[model samples]
Each structure stands twice: as structure tokens, then as C-alpha cells.
Target: MAGQAEIPADVVALCDYERHAAERMPAPLRAYVDGAGADGLTAQANLAAWQAIRLQGRVLADLRGADTGLRLLGLDLPHPLILAPVAFHGLAHAEAEHATALGAAATGSLMVVSTQSGLPLEDIAARAQGPLWFQLYMQPERGDTLSLVRRAEAAGCRALVVSVDAPVNGLRNMEQRAGFRLPEGIRAVNLDGMRPPQIRSEPGRAATFLGLMDAAPRWEDIAWLKSQTRLPLLLKGIMSAHDAERAVAVGVDGVIVSNHGGRALDTLPATAEALPVVARQVAGRIPVLCDGGIRRGTDALKALALGASAVLVGRPQIHALAVGGAAGVAHMLTILRAELEVAMALTGRRDLAGIDETVLWGS
Candidate 1:
């Protein structure tokens, strides 16, 4: 873990960490962390969509008793910014998720540990000072999935975020061009003997649609998942209003409006474009969280005005971790929280509840 003194003097904002990380990381690992689906169209759109939204600022508003605190999934979080789950933290820093857990705790931000994390889930849980949630990828067998869930439950994970978007890996061309591969001793520790062997395609048959997707999760699988865990269940990668409505109908605790950071599929609409529609479809039946292209505090406020309950910061966490380990992550989150407060004060809002569509230019 890095100390405060180790953080660079120029690292004053979240965006700055990206440049520093690119310089610090190996070329192959950097490409893997930054790559998205084919053509990189959707990933580029995510940032542009958020930047295009205009904020409406106000003057002479009361600022007393204002705070960023909010209650999410029965946890009273100090702020709405969450550390979005990213895999293979060891590729960026030596301490891996253990360092990230400490950084999140220091800033009072919730940390979602990925199913593909480099370290053991129990070890990460022990290092976290605040609440932790587990992001799960459904295994080929029901029993294998249940075992992961059981481990998460025993580790005291407060919620379960099931990623339902990608049935198979996307065509990440940038990663392929860079020849990215995980070095030895940095595999998904929890999935040592559990992940199913690759499915070989028959001659003259489709591989993805016919072979591997046979294990893809269906609606019935989600319903079965809900029955197996007492933790709050949130479905990630819900991009359509129809899917959001169906998630509510299936008795999910929440729905995350995301396009998997534009990593899972190419040419999909950005999360900023999908968030308002999904939030309206759910109609407050459950919390609607979103992740993708959130780099600034203003971006988070825009998401809330458009109807997101909270926003998740994804790639920036890794960038910060690479630059300064735990201290870098904490500083980056702290800077974002301060910016959120400034935006709220300038817009005449006292707290998170006071922020609504009115804060946006054309609400």
C-alpha cells in the first residue's frame, strides 16, 4: 500500500490517474484494463454522452446541514459513489483487492469484489473496513454457482450483484492486438477447480450461439438464484426498459443500468442514455444504479437527475490503484466526493434527496 507522500503532485483529479497509470503499467496489462468491444464505438460514446448533458447552476442557495450520505441496500453509505468491480487487481498493484478494500473503507465508499478477482474473496472481506458486496458470474453448473454464493454469504457480503449481460467474452480487438494474457500466479483464485472447461464447437456449427451459450443464464435461473440467497440481489447489465421491468417482476432487489462499461458488446447505447428509460420503467420499485463513463462528480449528479439512485466508478479505481496503490484510490474518491458537494451547493441543493431533474438544463 502507498502512503500519501507517494502520490504524485499532479494527481489532483480522477482523470489524471488514467495518464499516470498508462505510464506505470505494462503494455499488455494496460491494454487489457482499457480495452472494450470491437470498434471501440460504444466505449467512446459512454464518455461523450455524459459530457453532452448540461447542468443548471443556481446562486444564493442554503448550504447548511448538507451531506452526501445515502442508504443503499440497507447500508447507510456516507456517499453514493461505489467502487465498481474490476478483475485481476494484481495486474495493476501488488496488494490487489486487499489494497482497494482499504481505500474504499477510508472513503466510506462500498467496494464490489469481482468474481474474477485475483485474491481470495475471504481475504478481501477481512481487509475491508466497511461494507462489501460480491459480483457473481453464473457458472456452467448450478452447484458451482451455489458454492460461490455460499462463500460470499459466509464472508459477510451484504449483497449479490449478478452480471447477466455477457454469456461469453466479447471480441476485444485491442486486447488481442496487444497479446494480453494473465501471467502465472495471478489467476482467479476462487475459481481454481470450478470453472467449466471450454466448450469445443462441432464442425460447421456456430460456436458462441450454439455451443457455449448453452450455459447462459435464463430468467428461470435468476428466479432460482433469488430463492437461494437472503442477500439483496441486483442484476447488472440491464440496458433495456423491458428488461428492467422484467427484473422488477422477477422480484429482484435492484437493477443496474449498465452496458458493462461498453466492454460486453459493441454499438450499444451508453448507460447515460439507457438509465432514464430503465429508471422510469422500474418506477421506483427498486433502486436503479448505473455504471460506465463516470469520471467527474458532475457526471454522478447528472446521473441522479436523470433517475439513477447512485453511480459506480469502474476503470478509474484501477487507474488510481496503479498510480498509488491504496492512498491513490482513497484520494481519488475523496476528490470526487468533494466535487459532488460543490456541485450540490452551487445548484441550491442541501442533500442527495434535493437533487432531481431540475438540476439538469432541460428537465
Candidate 2:
């Protein structure tokens, strides 16, 4: 790739694969994938947050074969791993979302296909053998958003994931410096034919939130969206317990504690810091999942011990998809799963049920 040395067969870590993929990608797209908020503090925190708690591994336990299987929103996954929906996979490779979907299928991992997918939802769904969840970014018009949902349902998506934190794009220093623009060939193809609802904004001397997110959905909107579809509904980007409670009250089936990979708001607490509080707030009323800074199995295990029912891997899968297409996605997950199983065995856990807060050294 780009005259770079091919990825070594023994290089199992995601970071290594990412390095290999980075060699192939153009600078602007690399910045888009790796760059974070204003100063990248939040992005750094998403990775560093896991350092606070250490694992208390047990020495004297029967560590035979261990399983990492998990169920989220009624979908049984081979592991507690889900590939997070990231936009514009075409940036990494030519095959784009189709390759990523195939990778998820190969690993028996649940995949959340983004609203800004490079491929049509139907094509992605057809390629994924494992469960597919459509991550929704509401169109300015309600009917258009519902139309997208109907399309997902028709394409056999198992659940609907509504991203709630972003009304407007985050201020990304990297993208700004890189002069990032959607290159001529890549686009969010699935958004074709959607129209925006007219937004009325008054002339103002001071800033206001009203016009900030023209298509931003509110509580009533979420409730109405829930009523429009029978598919299991999940809310992503929830950081506060108050929001978690409101979502549960609004009848959402699950919650994903995320900080938009620290790409949205620059200074938000890492997803690692938010999951516990939200999990406590939900109080097992609904399944709670998490994403961001999940590079290793220990990181994932910590999320489970903190309160997540499962975890989603974003950049790692992208790296895999970039290098090996669907097969690359499979290899990346296989490595991640192996690391997780090793962590489980050393910690005296034989299965996911055996994992809890006790495994955390701080506990």
C-alpha cells in the first residue's frame, strides 16, 4: 500500500493494522479518521480513561475454555463486540461499507451501519450475515426519517440506533488543518433523495441553540420516532444519567454511552467515565452498551466490569476494513476476541456473566 511494507502476519494488534492502513490512505482522510475535537483532549481521554482502573487477575482458578458471547437488544453475538457505525468507509478503501459489513459477518459481530454509509443500506444488509443495526441521523423532515427507517426494516436491520448528541458537526482542528473536504469520489450515498424541513431562525446579536441543529430531534420527536417503528430502538451518545433516565422513560430499548469518539464536543468526559453513571441511572431497566477508545480486550473487559453489556470497536474495524476488506475486519475482530478471552481467563472468568465490578482492582 503506497509502497509501504505490507502488514506482517504476526502483527495482531489493531494499532499495527492501523499503521499499515494509514500508509495506504491519503493525508486528509487519515486526519478525518484519526483526528478528534478542538485540541483532541477528549479523544486522548477516550483512550487514557481506561488507565484509571486496573484488572485484578486471579492466579488460582480453573481457566479452561472461556466464552465471550453476549446478547444486546435480543441479538446474540459471538462476543461482546460490535463494530461501531463510522461514516464514509470509502475513505479507507474502495469497497467501503460493503467490505466492513462482510468483515462483521465473518466475525459474527453485530454491526451498526451508519446513516452516512458509502453504500446503500440494502446492499450492506445483504452482505452482513450477522445482525445489522441502522444508525439513524434524522432527516430534517419527519417523513423522510421514517422513510429511512422503513428502508432499514425492509433491508432486514434488527434494530434502529438513533445518534442523539450531535445537532451540528463538531469543531475538529485536524479536519480544519488538513483542509478536509469530501473528495470527489466519496459521499454519504444512502442519504439520497432526503429533503430538509425549513428552519426559521431570527436575526440575533447573541447566539441561540434553536437554529444550531436545524434537524435536531427533541424528546417528543424521539417518542414519536419510537412509535413509528416496531424495531428495537437504541439511543447513542448518551453521557448523563439524567439523559439515560429520560431515554428509558421515553421507552428506548437500550443506551450506548459514547462521546462521539471525542469528535463531537471537544471537552466531554471520555465514554469510559460516562458509562458507569448512565448504567446506574438506567438501573438495568434497559441494556447499556458503550463505545470509544476500545483498542484492546482489557479495555472492553473494563467497560463490562463498569456497567456496559457490550462494547463497540470503531477505528480498529476501519483499519481492518481498510487493509483486508471484509477478511481484514474478521482478522481484527479475531485478534480482539483472542485478547478478550485471554483477559477473561487470567481474571478467573469463564464467561461474560463471570465478569463484574469485582474484576476491577479499584473495586
Candidate 3:
């Protein structure tokens, strides 16, 4: 598995893991992994927007020992890139979330296990050697949400990432057209036995799901959630500066500027486009992380230059897991770390902290 290079060298491999995953996965799984919400404009835009940003490279500086190390929410990470939470790893491979946990730990990157994951939180934690954060979905029942949070804390998860974007699933037209559904055997083990609420397809399941979302976590609920865990609280799916400011005001430990990988809202700004404004709003009071459309080390560098403490990758790692399980994931991280180092050297930045707004052009 280590020596295999399913993807060609000339291919600007964002992560070798994804290439392997694409080769191994069937059409249905591939479509599911690749599908975005609605027309997928947001998803497509996520990548496009990053390409739109141009970097100003510096020359003649001592770039011999560049570092990608970063400290986010008090945890030291080898790089400023993290694996974003993706659901139902069982859909990608047999090892499911366990393989991903092992791979993330192998490369010293953090993993945010999804509530919709196939494996239980405890099982993934048992295999993980690095930091783990639990991604929570505010289910219809508060008890279910609370139960999951408690379970994650018990399993040694260091933080709780409340996914605020998916109040309900987005209108993923591709999945709907493909008749996508989680296979029977691969259920969200965390929510097993207790059926939360059936998504009403007749009236559009997306709407039903959105309706159930606590719709903007009230300040009190945010306060209550914070009280529930000693771990730092991070609110995901934030896009606007207003929300970022509110998040900090309410005492959030961090804010992830994401559009749920453009899987929720179709018309929102790409995460990259929204990052600088939100980062400025947060003003270093708390960590500001960006997710959605990050496919290269340069993208990570650009985000860091714009004030993001770290960047989260959503689909690429899942693609790696689909192709080669744990080994694929490790390969993908290895490639990304190397690419990030190269980007740092080329940009004349010695470390992640050195990448500031000065490196960006055209705002």
C-alpha cells in the first residue's frame, strides 16, 4: 500500500489519498463523496475562489528551515491544516472512521469525528494517537445532542465542534438524482436505536432537516453548551463577520468560517472569500479557522496569510480513505505537508506565523 501511486506524478496531486479513493470507490459512493448541495455552485466556487487569489513571492531571504507548525486552541499541530469532519466513513471503506483516526494521528494532524460517522466515538478515540474533536449535530431532541457530547468527552475528545450550518441537510441534487441513501448496514452508530426524526421527502427532506435545526444557536444555548464541556467550544459554519463577532462575544473558543463545504447554502460566499473579514472581526481574540475549497498547500498558506489560524480539508481525505484506507490517508497528509513546506519556502516565509496579510494581493 505504501509504494502504490495510483495517481500519476504529473497530476499536481493535492493529496495522494484522494486519487486512491477515487480509483477504488464505486459510482454511487463516489457521487456521494463528490456531491455538493443544490447546483453545487458553492462547492465549485470553493475551489475556484481560492485559485482567484494571487500570491506575491519574496526572494533572497534565508528559507533553509521553514516550519509549518501551528498552535490552535492550545494544541500544537505540525501544520496549520486539519482534517474536516465528513460523515459515514463506512460508506468509503470497511475500516471506516478508525482508519481516518489512525491516518490523522500518523501525520500529527487533528481529526474531527462526525456525529454521523459509522464508528462509535469511543472506538475511533481508542485508535487515535493525536487530538480528537467531536462534531455535533443538534438533533431534534436535546437529550440526544447532550448524550453525544458526553460520550465524546468520555472518549477523550478535547473539544466540541458544533456544526451550525447543517440545520438540516442541503439540497444535494446529485445525491437525490442518484437515489443516494446510506446503506442499511452502515448506520450512524451514535444515533442507533433512537430515531430522531424522519426527514420528510414528500415536503423535501432538506427543509424538514433545516426546520429542526435549532436555527442559530441562541446565546443562552451557546452558553449552556459551553457549560456542558470543559473542552474549548468551536462553532462551525460561520460565514459573516457579524456571526464571528457574536461568537467571540458569547465566549466561543474558536470560529470555523465554513459553508459546510458549500453543501448547505448555495448562494453564500465561498469560505475563502469570507475568511479575511471574519478573521479581522475576531481580531485574534480567538482562533479563526477556514474550511471549504482548500485543496493545496498554497491554499493553506493563503488562508494563513489572511488571518486563519488553520485550514480544514473536507473531501480530499475522504477520497484518500476510500482509495487505500489508513495508508491512503497517511500518504495524503504526507504529500500535503511536503507541499506546504514547499509553498512556505517559495513564499519566503519561515513559519506559519510569518504568513500574514502582506503575502496576499488584490485584497
Candidate 4:
């Protein structure tokens, strides 16, 4: 609930918020927010991949009435950036998802609320002034997953972003090193009373192989869930052309090329690398969105040029929330949108449609 005054004058960009947030938050909390999987190769790669892409600048092109707006799944977004779903916002700010919702609404940015949100989906939906899309982690029981989808539909969620990667937690070594644990009273409120079916492994069998992954949702589960919900369904964690084609064949609404922010698995290809390939495979049959290592406006522009219809910003939302609560996050999105405009103006692109592989050098 912090006001605009809480936003520091020097915090002009998302990276600035990242630095301020580290100083403001507890070490363990920061570790949990920043940590990636083992060796951090993929996380580093995500950032580097975006940086490696070069934009082509144009001169003397008409730039009148430039726009950043776009429509996805029938929802009109003021800009192409979305607040990617991240779990347990309470770890960053006391207002938690409520603050994030207010911030997103303030700037007309769409937010995908996590299945593991610290606040109830209904409560967050009530506070959100803009659009809310629920990110679903399909449960072991079809009934349980369907119930969650029904709640989201009843709460006015515009879409369902089903995360399909990580049936198990990633090997987050940094979190382990910091001994990170969710503070008392902070939990996934939406998941309360829903118990996962037990999967016991016999002796001499690896539990992860024999039991834990048994709960992972398969392609059939996604198709079945799509049948149960009327909402536009998007599959997250898509990193390959084959999966993208499969998703299209399965009749899903959209695909988000992601590596779980490099938190799900190490050494995986960054979203920047995966996006173009997936976008090509889908062939515009569905919208392609991506998240991972998107810290600047130029990064978003790069993603779009590479075939992403829109890009999602994840960790930066937490960094902004931790630093200045709701206002901080609002300011963060404002900065990104402004930067996108600047990039577009310089690249001689009047609207998002003007952006394509042509904007990238050596395309």
C-alpha cells in the first residue's frame, strides 16, 4: 500500500528496483526470489541471450500516433508486458498479491495470479482493477483441478495459464544454502484443504522416479482440463517446437515459452532462445508468450521481434513490490512501458505489429 513517495527518485529502471529490494528484504527472502536451479547456467543464459540480440535502428520513418496496445485471448492489454505468475508474494511485501494487483491495475497491465499465491484467488480478484489470469498447476485429481478452474472462472479470471513444466521442484541450491523457508502465516491460501494423493515408492526405487512425478499432469490432462474450462487456456513452460505443435494439436489457446524462470531445471534453453522456435512451430495458430530474464524494455522488444506476441516479467515484480509496495510496482511497469515506446520510436515502429524479425539485426 505504499504510495508513490515510497518510490525512490534514483529508481528509474527495473534493475534499480532489484538492487533496492535486496537491501530492503531479508537475506533468505532475497535468496528465494533470486535463486535458480543448480549451477545457474540457464538463468544466466536467459539474460545473456536477450543481451546478445541486436536491434536495428531506423531513421526518417513515420512514428505518428505510436501504440503499444495488443489483444490476446480477447482481452485488450494497454501494453504487451504481463505480470508473470510468481508464488508467495507475501515474502516480498506485506500486502502481497493485493499490492501487485493494484500495481498492475494502475498501469493496465495484465497479471497472471499464481496457483501458489499467498492470497486467496477470490480476494486478489476482488482487488484487481485490471485483468486477472489464473496460472494453474494441475493437481493429481481431476476434480481438484476442475474445482480450482471453476473458482477462477467465478472470480472473473479472463484466462487460464496452465504451467506444465516441473512436476517436481528444481534443484535450487542457493535456496538450500540460505535455508529459505516460507515464514509462518504465509502459505498458498488457494490450495488449502486440497490434499495431493500420496505416491509411495517401494524400497530400492528412487522416490522422484517412482512416486513424486506420478502427480505430474500429462498431455491428456491438459486436454481434459481445456474441456472443463471455458476460459482461454495457455500452456506455460513450453520450450520446444514439438511441444508447441502438440499444444496446437491439443487445441489449447496459447503457449508461453518459458523455463520456469530457470528455476525448474538447470542448463535448459532460455526463453529468448526457445521463443522463436516455438513461435515458428505454432505458425500464428495461437499467441506465443514468453517469460524469463526480461528485465528491460529492450528485452521485451527483442522477444516480440523473435515472434512472441507478448512478454511476461516475473522477478522484477517482486523486486518492485519489496522496494515500494504497490506504487513501486506501478512505477516499475510505467518505466518498462516508457522504455518500450522509446525503443519503438527509435526503431521506427509505430505499433507492435511493426515489430518483427526485421527489427533485429542480421535477421
Candidate 5:
């Protein structure tokens, strides 16, 4: 709170956002947001992912009633922004997932509540004023996984965003360096009593990642999982066309081309670079959503022009929530929507459908 005198409480850009957040959080939590992740290359790459493409400006177009609204997977949004799932919200604010649910609803945006959410899924759902999706992290036990999915379904979640990227949390150097760990009181409340999976390690040898993944769900689990629920299933963390093809072949309703925001496997290509190719593979058979290093309306527009049905924004919203809770999150979306509108008008794009590769300079 020492810097509160200098940094403004409200943020319209990154500088103020970072300043206020630093004023409030302990050093370890800041590192959780800004550091770690495979020498930080993939995370750093995400920041610059949209730099290469430039939008083409058109002279004039019929701009009457210009809008940024979009429809995806049976949900209508006032704009193309979707809130990506980020966990451990209690670290940022006491309201945790409950505040985020309210914030998403306030902005008419959708939020994918994480399995690691600080509040119970039901509590968060009670606060949501708009559509909600639940992100799943396939519990070690199939029964536990099914139980959470059933809860989300009963709570009115529109979809299940199954995150496949992080079979385990990334090897976060900064988290280790800062000695960061979840506070004792804060935990994944939805999974309060579930059994963690068992792993067999060799004598004096650490259990390997491949070993843990082996204990985890595999590609073949899709069919059985689908049979257990009626909600639309979206496989997140997909980056390759081959995986997209496989997902479609097996009846996936959607795929998000994400590199886990560079928090999962390091050295993966930025979501910006991977999205176009993955979108091409889906060929509109299923909606393609993407997220990574997105900060402004221009970033979202660049992604849409590259063939994403919509874009996901995670880190920035968290920053806003850290600064001012639900209202702050709404303001961030408001600024983004305004920016998107200006970008659309300047580029002579009338609507979401009008965005295409042609808008990009080298496409």
C-alpha cells in the first residue's frame, strides 16, 4: 500500500494496472503473474505475437450501427471478448471467483471458471449475470471428474472447457524462486475431498512428467466422458492442425488454440502463430477460440482476422480484478470494446463477419 499515493487506482493502460497491482500484492504473487514459465520465453513471445501483422485501413464504408457482437457455441455476446479461465483468484481479492463471475456478467462476457477456482462452482454461478463455462482439469479419478462436470451442468454452465495442456503445473522457476505456494486457506474448493492420483516412482528417482501423464486421462477418454454429460465440450490448449482434426473426428464441439498462455509446455509456438493453421483445419466445423498475450482491441482484431471465431483475455482482466474487483473488470472490457469499435471503423470493417485475413497486411 506504500505506492498507493503515487499510482492511480483506475487503469486505462498497462502502466497504471501494473503499478496498482504491485502496490497491493506480495512479491511472490506478482511473480506468479509476471514471471516463471520455461525461462519465460513462451510467455515473453506471447507479448509480441501480434506485432508482425498490420491492419489495412479502408477509406469509407457504410458504418451505420457498427457493432462488435458475436455468437459462438449457442451464446450471444455483445462483443468478441471471452474471459479465459485463471485460477486462485483469492490471491488477488477476497471475493475470488464470486467477484469474477459478477464481473463477467456485468460486461456481457463469458468466463470459464477454473477447476482451481477459489470459491465453490455453485457460489460463483450464483453471482454470474451472464453465460458461464467451467474449465475442467480431469481429476485423477474418473468419478471425481464426473462429479465436478455434473455440478457445473446443474449450476447452468453452458459448456465444459476441458484444459488438456497442463497435465501438471508448468515447471515455474519464478514460483520456486519466490517460494510461492497457495495459501493454506485458499484451495480448489470444488475438489475439496477428491483423491489425488497415485504415481509409482523408481527408487531414488523422481517421478517423471511422462509418468504423471500416464496416470492421467488419455485421448481415448473423450467418448466415455461425452457419454456422461450433455453439455458442449471444448478441448483447450490445442495448437496443431493434426490435433484439431482428431478432435473434430471425435465429436468435439470446439477447440481453443492456446499454448496455455505459455504457462504449460514451454517452447510451444505463440497462440497467434498457431491459431490460423488450427482454424484452417477445423474449417468452421467447430468454433475456434484463442488466447495468449492479448492486451488491446487491436490484439483481439488481429486474432479474429486470422480466423478465430473469438478471442480469450485472461491476464489483463485479472490485473483489473486485482485493482478494483468486478467493477474494474467491467471497465477493462468497456475500454476494450471501445477500442475494438474504433479499430473496426478505421479498418472499414462493418462487423465481426467482415474480419478476415485480408485485414492483415501480409495475408
Candidate 6:
């Protein structure tokens, strides 16, 4: 609420939240949140790519009764945006994922719980009032992955999102330079007590965590994963039209066009650039959601027009939680919702359905 008036008048206030968060968080945490692959070209491009798409406004339409609600994969969302899966929220705040889940659900938005979440999935689920989706990072073995899926199902998660882009961890030079690592006593709760795949690195090294990730999930593995969970399966980190088509063919419930927030690959195309092509490839057979570089309501509007059922916010919400806990996250979502509503009204698009390619001009 501190910057409410400014959000409608200027987009810079939305970004201010990130700056405030950086000041509030410790150096290591800030580094992890701000860092991207290699030179951060893809990270910078993610934000720039969205800015390049201009909106074409329609005038003189009756916008008296505008609505932002959308039905994504059978769930009715008040807006076409959801909180992206970010691991170890506890690193940001003491309340961690619970605070975020509560804030998102309170705003009628969805929350995607990461496999590496600091809090237990059930605890986060217990606080949610809106839809909850579990993000899966398949363990080194099939049994471990299946077990995690079953636990998520028991925790009342409505859908399963399998992140497939991180086959191998990306090079994060910032974390290394800052000498940052997951703090002691913050082990991923779901993975607690399990002997995670060992990182074959020098002892007491930052890269040790990378080896713990089993980044290999082949097409057959996807099939096996599908058979393991009854909940609808969504494939995240999809950037290619070919992979989008493959996801549809493999019977994925939906596909999220993402570049892993440019955290996985240094030179990958921004999510915005990849969305339209993937949307075309899917051709409405399935929903195509996108995430990465969505900082403002207009950025989200651009994504919707280009071909996304909904957009997901990663760093923005995390920064919010880091700065002001539940209140900050709530305020951030509230600001974004208000901006989206105003943008829709001003553009003469009264509803989510009214947003389409007609409103966007690509550079």
C-alpha cells in the first residue's frame, strides 16, 4: 500500500520492492536471488524482451464490468498470473513458504510448491485457500521421485509440475563469489534424512549442492512420472516449440514456457520470445503458461496477448516476502492485480479473453 498510487502512474515502484528486498536480505541471499547464469545476458534479456512488446489499445468500448478471472487447467484463477516455484523460501523469511502460500491464496492466486521448499509441503498446503500445485525435481532414482509424488498427493496438492529444464545445474558465479550456500538447519524438508545424490566436489564447496541434483529426465522418464501421479501433470521450463508439441503428444495437462528464470541457461531465449511459437505449436490443444521477467502488470498483459493462459512471477513475490513477509507478498500481488485491472480497462479489454495477439506488436 505504500506505493499503491505510484503503481498505476509509474511502473518503477514495482521494481522498488526488489531494491528494498536486496537491502533487507543478507549479501548471500541477495546474490542468490539476483544472480543469473554466466554474464546474466538471459536474465537481462528476460526483462528487456517483455518491454519490447508494445500494446495496441482499443478505445470507446463499454468497460463497466471488467473481469480478470481465468480458468486454467480446470481451476478458476482471479487473474492470469500465479506465483512461480522458488525453492528455500525459508532463506527469505522465518515464516517461509507458509507466509507466501497464505498471501497468494488470500489474493485468489495459485502457489506452486517446490520440491526443495524449506517448509514441508503439507504445512504450506494447510495455509492455502486457493489452488496448490507441487513442483517436482525427480530424485536420482525413480523410487524417490515416486515417493515424493505420493507425499504431495496426500498433502492435497491439486497438480504436479515437473521441471525438466535443469538437466544439469547452470553455472551460478554469483553464489560462488558471495560464498553463499543454503544455511545450516535449512535442508529441504521433503528431502530430509534421504541421502541425496552426492556432489563429487571438494569438501566445503558451493558446487557440492549441484551434484545432489539428478538433472536427467528423459522422455521415458516423463512417461514413468506421468504414471506415478493421479493429479494432472504440467511440464515446466519448456522453451522450444518442439518440446511443447512433445508435451502435448505425451499428454501433459499443460506446458509453462520458461527459461528457468534465465537461471539455468546463460544464452537461452527469453520466455516471452519463446511463448508465441510454443502457443502456435500447441494450437489450443493444451494451455501454455509462461514465466520469467514478469515484473509489471503490462509485462503480464504482454505475455497474455502473445499466448499464455497465465503468467508466473518468481523474484518479485520472493522479494516481497523477503522485505515484508506475508504483508509484502500480499501488497505486491494486490499492486499487480490493480495494475492489471487498470490496464485492461484502459485498453478497452474487459476480460482475460479480450487479451490477445491483437493488442501486441513484437519488435
Question: Could you give candidate 3's per-residue lDDT for residues 1-363 as a string of tens digits?
Answer: 343335444434754556656677776777788888899999989999989899888788787676788777778888877899999988877888888888888899999999888888888998788899999876666667788888998999989999887766788888888877788988788888654664444453444544454343466788778877788999998899898988998888999999998888797888889998999899999999999988888888888988899889889888877766777677777877887788878778998878897787753
Model 2, residue 74: displacement in angstroms?
1.7
Task: Tell me the whole-model lDDT of each prediction, alpha carbons only.
Answer: 0.91, 0.86, 0.82, 0.92, 0.83, 0.84
Report the alpha-carbon TM-score of model 3 versus the true structure. Answer: 0.92
TM-score of each: 0.97, 0.94, 0.92, 0.97, 0.95, 0.91
- RMSD (CA, Å), each prediction: 1.4, 2.8, 2.7, 1.3, 2.8, 3.8
Point out the worst 10-residue segment of candidate 5 by lDDT. 1-10
Model 1, 133: alpha-carbon shift in Å?
0.3
Tens-place lDDT per residue, model 5, 123-236, is 888767789999998987888999999999999999999998878778888888998888889988888999876777677865555367666777878767877888999999
lDDT of 4 by residue, 197-240 (tens): 57786878755776678778899998898888789999999999
Candidate 1 lDDT score relative to the true structure? 0.91
Residue 176's lDDT in candidate 4: 93
Following a full C-alpha superposition, what root-mean-square deviation does model 3 have from the true structure? Answer: 2.7
> Model 6, stretches more than 4 Å misplaced?
1-12, 198-215
How many pairs of residues in model 5 come into backbone collision? 0
What does the lDDT read for residue 172 in candidate 6? 83
Q: Could you give me the TM-score of model 4 versus the true structure?
A: 0.97
How far does residue 189 in candidate 1 sit from its true spot (Å)?
Answer: 1.3
